[model samples]
Target chain A: MKQRLSTLMVAAVMTASFAAHAQQPAKKAPPPAKAAAPAKKEGITAEFEKFREVLEEDNPAELFEAKGEDIWKNKKGPGGATMAQCDLGLGAGVVKGAYVQMPRWFADVGQVMDAERRIVHCMVKYLGYKEEDIRKQPFSNDQRTPDHVSVITYVAAQSRNLKIAAPQKHAKEIEAYRIGKEIFAYRAGPYDFSCATCHGDDGKRIRTQDLPNLRKPAEAVKAYQGWPGYRMTGGFMLTQQWRMNDCFRQQRFPEPTYLSDSITALLAYMTVTANGQVYKGPGIKR
Target chain B: MADPMKIRAQMKGDTAEIRVLMSHAMETGQRKDNAGATVPAHFIQAITVDVGGKRVIQGQTSTSVSRNPVFGFKVKGAKVGDKVVIHWEDNKGDKRTDEAVIAA
Candidate 1:
């Protein structure tokens, strides 16, 4: 009888331990099949990564960077001087590391200018390159010559690997930053869209494309490097001017004048808000 | 605009990929009326594609082509590593030409 009781107790204990183990979910068990469906349906991140990989090779911006270098050095404007002599806020004649410091205030220029606007000033003053003409012919047939797009690429390329250091030293710089933040958040368009509409948050997309939150540092850096990119959709190589122009049109807003202060302000916002990020341009885009 | 337009092309196997980025506003003509007069008809008339030196695709397009238009397509037998050339012209005698390389 004693032996039988001991056997029974051992059996019961084993059963209880087994039951407890089953009750505690196994850590390595395949996740319930039902949970997989919802995860698969919300496949935003995976899609974005695939699309980005497609653009990894042979970015067309290399061409623009090459041309921009020529425009920077070659003397062509009415002034018959090379833009190499102009100041990009790294002091006169310094092109290195100037791009990442832009959207900052310049006491001499008396306004906050982004990379493109500053390039325009240099072209006009030092190179005698007329602003009107350059703006009108954003893309020149003379692929051999440096056009506005090429110059932008060149300047932006120079700042590659440099951190965004848009100076907040001047009062005007602060003012521009404030205005830029408002503009970014301000929504008024046919679609009631703002820059925030597409880029205000994380994990948003247009079709298979990823839309980065401009408010985030990593995302901003990833995007800021791609302006002045060659858009496969627009055959002509385009600069920031063309990019902003298209954005406004897509928003169904009236055309902003080329190189207008409003656009400049927007650029200021994009650059400064992208503080500590590097500038990479003439990137190839879809 | 000395040369009205130009196109160059190439082709590969099993795909007829082409790239066309044209220079035209592709104005929809439905835009506002100065004096309420409707804007006249203005649009791209045709686009031709050549792959590896053979005409593969020809399309008739309208003003709906975006400004500085661009297009991509795949066709039979166009292989990877082929060069695709495209040409486009408008009713107004404006034209443009561009090319791209094919990849699988």
Candidate 2:
């Protein structure tokens, strides 16, 4: 419980209205003096950055973290087992610093796994849940949220402040990384835009939201760290797995399968690109 | 299974600080899904806080509020070990109440 956290963590929804109010005024002003300005990205991007500063104080993700911590220890599923003993690649039941090492090798599945995929694996193997049932509702929607998402928020938060060091020792992990790199570059869909179109270049944005050039190390580090974040726009906690899927949606491509090998490969590519950077997340995002 | 709300209550001298995070769609009914179907509005209309079974703070909310909203308040004349209960009622009449104990 972060009850006394000195940092001013805002209640969700309250600040979004403020951000919306701040977004339009600058653009509506007489354009003569500001129109010729280079890039002209200052209006909404500046406002969002300021808004992010305020949200950064206390992320709503912490609420999920609290719920997740309880779920980790409580018995559930058909097997009546707690998720506490499931291995996160650092050995059984070890949570701290486990997330940063993931998208790494796991000998049991014999392939590299992302947090969602791994959690699903644990759910099946340890808790006796069906994979198809688990995959059916992986993302949170208007009606409800799968327990897995909060579990992930709990798992990912454990690595807060640790350096991202995704292992490439295994051939499978290396291959996953290579596949992820390629996925990051492969362009297609209605817009013919790859992740590169937005994330490949520096200082790119869709509207007011700033896009991080995940190709570069520092930006990758910063972007990669905060995922499984609370999104102000969507009003939900989104996992990195959800991040990959949403990106594909925005690209006008068909929906990407949750925790598919391709998505894991993309994560391998990103976390690896962000290697050696300090992770400070379970972050709040716009 | 019902959706859970997170509650934290910390006693600061004579006053107890309480914060709550509620998980709800808060769907505005105006938005559409990817399939273009209208998502009906579902949101918390009111929130009440009680300590030691006594009513204290009551507030109202609307659809304009964001999903999974967070709210915090300070209660006077509170002490450590006092039980803090938060009850919320949505427009659909769906209700959730969660409680926490104040820390000394």
Candidate 3:
């Protein structure tokens, strides 16, 4: 009888232990499956960054490349000549590998010319298009690229993968470079901000995007070379010249004239700083 | 025509892997211009993919899709030397069609 009672007691103890184990919910059986993916935020951020890198592999700037070629080949002015023979620092009829070396002193114009200004010179000298009308619009809208802007993207794309080597020769180029440094440091806008306010320090950021210090050569290459790019946010294809005008506007200063000395000088600073990097644009921009 | 879409289709064993970069704004129309003008609603509504003239994929999209949309997908039973074609139509009635051949 004692043995029978002891056996029954042992069975009771076993059942109680089993019930207690099931009640705690601390074991890895059922609850762990639900907690398998706990680090949701980190996983998502890593995934999004990977996705962006993959998306940038094929840039959409080629669309403007086609349009720019067509515009260059077609006649626009009463002079009835295409811009095929207009000089862009590398001599007439040379569109390839000329962009990375521009913002240089042009003996004909007697000033350094960026892509837009050089194209304007060609429009005037070869195509006989009025300079005033060309400057009337320096940016593109929803429908079409302004002639000069399209030409800039086209020329820049041709120079892609070539080293950026804008010359610092000529007394005028040296003077422009000096003035560009002054402008980058000058702080007299309503907000008392210059390009230095945000870009003076490396690793500084406005929001989620990191602002590349244009003063630093390594970062300047990353920032300056990829312009005339298609900006996804504004749904606009922007030129480097347009970007200069907008930067001043953001600081509440009078906007810089398109391809003006003020604008070109700042670009000269960036170009000189980025002397050896290869051009890899028109790049995709946020 | 606008620039042709950049596409790559590669055949691996029995499947075809394709990647495409399309030039489009995919504008949601919820934004405004610098002049405070209301940007109109314009976006791609549909995309279709075909293998050697046989339709393989048809996708629908909205403003949720980002601008300059990049897309990728896989197809079964593909071999080298087959042609892959892709086309997309936007709400504004603009369409672009481009094709690539599957390379081994």
Chain B TM (all candidates): 0.66, 0.91, 0.94
Clashing pairs in 3: none
Find the candidate with the highest TM-score and give its number: 3
How close to the true structure is residue A253 of candidate 3, measured as C-alpha lDDT? 94
True contacts kept of each: 0.03, 0.10, 0.10
Q: TM-score of model 3 relative to the true fold?
A: 0.78
lDDT by residue (tens digit), candidate 1, A56-133: 333445545655676778757664677867788988878888888887677786888887888888777877767777
Per-residue lDDT of model 1, residues B30-75, tens digit only? 7655477765666678777666566766778775444444344546
For residues A70-105, write the lDDT of model 3, one tens digit per residue.
778776666577787888888887988888887889
DockQ of candidate model 1: 0.03
Worst 10 residues of 3 chain A by lDDT: A6-15
Candidate 2 or 1, higher lDDT: 2
What does candidate 2's lDDT look like per residue over B1-104, in tens digits?
34677777887766677767777777788998888999888878988878756677677888877777766667776678878888999988899989999887
TM-scores of the candidates are 0.60, 0.77, 0.78
Candidate 3: C-alpha lDDT: 0.74
State which docking tier applies to candidate 2: incorrect
